[model samples]
Target: MAATLPQDIKLHTKSRTLELIYSDQEQFELTAEYLRVHSPSAEVRGHGIGNGVLQTGKQLVGIKGLEPAGNYALKIIFDDGHDSGLYTWEYLYDLCQEQENYWNRYLKALADAGETRHGNMIAKG
Candidate 1:
C-alpha cells in the first residue's frame, strides 16, 4: 500500500519548522535542526549501511525553500546550503511518527560526541 501524503505542507520560516497537515486531522511540525540532522542524503545517511555522519551546529538552521520532487518527495533548500536530500512522503511520515524517539537518540548521540547543537564542543564538567 502507498503511504499517505500530507494534504498540505507549510514552511514557517520565522519558526524554522516544516508543518505537515494530513486529511485525517493529523499534523506534525518538524524543526529545521531535526530535519537537517535526519536528512536522508548521502552526506548524512552515508554511502552505505552504518557509517552515518553526525550533523552538528544546526540549532538555528532554517528552511530557505522547498521544491517538489516529482510526486514522491520534496527537495528542501536549507539556509546552510544543504539541498541534496529528497524527503519522500513515506520517509516524512515515518519521521513524523517517530519524532520523539529520533530526537532523543540525536540528543544522546550529540552528548556522546561532546558536541552541541550550536556547533560547539561541550565543556568538560
Candidate 2:
C-alpha cells in the first residue's frame, strides 16, 4: 500500500522558483532548472536507475505550469518544454531534505567525469 501523504500542502513562488511545504513539516525549494533536470519522467530519468541523461544548459529554466495529480503528486511543466515528471509528495519531500547532499554529489560526479555543467568546456584535439 502507498504511504499516506501530508494533510496540508502549501506552495510559495519566488522570482523563478517554487517552494512546497507538507504537513509533515518537510519542505522543498524547487528551482526550475533542478526540477527540469531531475524530472522522474522517462525522458529525463529514463526507464531505470543509471539510465538518466545528463541535462545541461538549463540554468535559467523556470516553471511554466503546474497541474495536480489527485492527492499524491503534481505534474510540472517547465519553460524548456519538459512536462512529464510526476512529483509525488513523498519523493518531493525527500528531494528537499536531500538537495544539498545530492547537489554536492552531482558536482563531484561532474568533476570526476571531467565535465562542466555549463557545457562551455571543449575537448582538446
Candidate 3:
C-alpha cells in the first residue's frame, strides 16, 4: 500500500527553487524549471499512457506561488504564468525519492531523442 502523506507539509520557496519538507522530516529541494516541465498535468504528461509531451524552454523558470489543494495535493504556480497541475502527495514523494534517477533518465532521453531541453536543436534519432 502507498504511504499516506504527512499532516504537516511545508514549502519554502527561494529565488529559483522549492524546498519541500514532509512530516517525516524528509526534505527535497527542486528547481522551478524541473517542476514546471515535469508537471503531472495532461498538457505535459498527457491523458493516457505514451502521450507525454516534450516540455522545452523551462531552464530558468521559478515558482510564483504555492496553493494548497485540500490535503492531498498542491497547485504550483510558475513564474512563466503556468498555474495548473495539481501535484498529489504520492506523486510528490515519488518525485523526491527518485529525483536523481529521474533527472539522469530525462537527460539521457533528451540526448537519445536529439531534443534539447532548451529547444536549441533537434537531435537525429
User: Relative to the true structure, how large is the alpha-carbon lDDT of every model?
Assistant: 0.89, 0.69, 0.74
Residue 40 CA displacement from its true place in model 3, Å: 0.6
Give the alpha carbon lDDT tens digit for every residue of 14-102 in model 2: 45567765535555566766666678889977788798877766666667778889977988877667888899877776777788887
In model 1, the Cα lDDT at residue 39 comes to: 97
Residue 77's lDDT in candidate 1: 88
Model 1 spans with C-alpha error above 4 angstroms:
1-3, 120-125
Please give the RMSD to the true structure for each candidate, in Å.
Answer: 4.8, 6.1, 5.8
**Of candidates 2 and 1, the better by lDDT:** 1
lDDT of 3 by residue, 1-125 (tens): 13646445444455577776664567678777678878999999898999998777677666767888997788998767778899988887788889988888778877787877674422221
Q: What does candidate 1 score in Cα RMSD to the true structure? A: 4.8
TM-score for every candidate vs. truth?
0.92, 0.75, 0.80
lDDT of 1 by residue, 1-125 (tens): 25469988999988989999986669999998899999999999999998899999988788889999999899998888899999999999999999999999999999999988985533221
Which wins on lDDT, candidate 1 or candidate 3? Answer: 1
lDDT of 1: 0.89
lDDT for position 87 in model 2: 90
In angstroms, give how far residue 25 of model 3 lies from its true place. 5.3
Candidate maximizing lDDT: 1
As for candidate 3, its clashing pairs are: 114-123
Ranking by TM-score: 1, 3, 2
